[model samples]
Target: MDLERPVQIVWQGPFTLAAAIASSTAPSKGVYQIYGQHIVFGPNSLLYVGMTDGQTFGARLAQHRDRWLVHEDDVTIRLGVVADLDSSARLADIEALTIWWHSPPYNSKNIWTYGGGPLRIQNLGARGRLHPEYSSHWKPARTPPDGEHP
Candidate 1:
């Protein structure tokens, strides 16, 4: 193996990534959330939504590498950082938006269920983009009083 030459090593695994602050709780108090795109490599190539409040792009990636846990498959991941400094919210909105957009199956994390039962699970891996909006297990809550934070 030559050190100077690039090598291709493939593996699949689980990841416990430590993300940089996606959106600041306080837009005025903190750096406005910069919306951007990053890349992730694994047995399954996934493009996820991400935003940050700081400039520790490389370090944030390093945290992903360090915390990721190998599953039945060995997976390697990489991220390319971009910025969108106009919004107060972080990547959560994008995550939900994309999950509803793509609807990929077998990816359960997108369901965002804290754990209840089958009714709580959702089809997260939809490549064809069919968002029918099923599951009525949860109810919507009314907004808090004006100028009040929930």
Candidate 2:
């Protein structure tokens, strides 16, 4: 991945699984965001950020629907299709950066440590609650002073 160029993600939809499956433009591999009610963030809050490698967006979202449908909140999904990516690593980098930046309630990993180097992501179209751009870089761990115990 080129650190200089921002990865462009073309976002579409706050759709249900059935709707996404029916859509002609949805991609098979990309990052997705799940939105619904949250105890704290309330209605239409971003609940999770996830990526699909080999599976279609419909299939990936079906899995989430199985898990989330039991709850009372209505689940909606938004797909982020990368407009310029060289490899799957770029896809994972996008997912990691999005999760790290957004800190969605259901996403537990990649909030602290991510494998990729510095990356900048540009979200285009229907971003919803996500930032328009994200620049991800490593942050040094804080160390306590000589007499202090953490």
Candidate 3:
């Protein structure tokens, strides 16, 4: 989506997996980040970034509880609740941008192919291990084929 205004996300939490799954204050739909030890990235590095549109954060996080609970390095989660725009598409945009910028290892897809127009985002509050601002755009190089004139 072409976002004319910067999307503002107010991040909250560094909650344990159990706490996040039981958090009553967490937003029902938004982006989230998981941080924990990584073999290459070491301890407390961002591991995954995800979003939920139809499910509550508790429900969504609960789905991954088993995997995150297995980590020994104190896995924590952060929730990014969008300020004004709460559309699923906007949530997806925020999720994609966060993943693209951080390159968190657990996120295998959408690393290079977050296909959307230019966007601007402002991160507020406790944004663990994420930049305060992000600007995303994709412009592929184009060359005229066989003697095309400019």
Each model's lDDT: 0.30, 0.79, 0.78
> Among these predicted structures, which one has the highest TM-score?
2
Residue ranges of candidate 2 with Cα displaced over 4 Å: 138-150
Q: Using Cα atoms with residue i matched to residue i, what is each candidate's TM-score against the true structure?
A: 0.31, 0.84, 0.83
Which whole-number lDDT from 0 to 100 does residue 77 have in model 1?
A: 32
Off by over 4 Å in 1: 1-44, 47-50, 69-84, 103-150
lDDT (Cα, 0-100) at 69 in candidate 3: 52
* Cα lDDT tens digits for candidate 1, 19-104: 33232221221111111222333344343322234544334444444653212233323222213323334333333433333333
Select the stronger candidate by lDDT from 1 and 3. Answer: 3
lDDT of 2 by residue, 76-113 (tens): 87888898667888788889888877778788787665
Ranking by TM-score: 2, 3, 1
Q: lDDT (0-100) at residue 149 of candidate 3?
A: 30
Sorting all predicted structures by lDDT, with the top scorer first, yields 2, 3, 1
Any idea how many clashes model 3 has? 0
Largest lDDT belongs to which candidate? 2
Which residue pairs in candidate 3 have backbone atoms (N, alpha carbon, C) closer than 3 angstroms, thus clashing? Answer: none
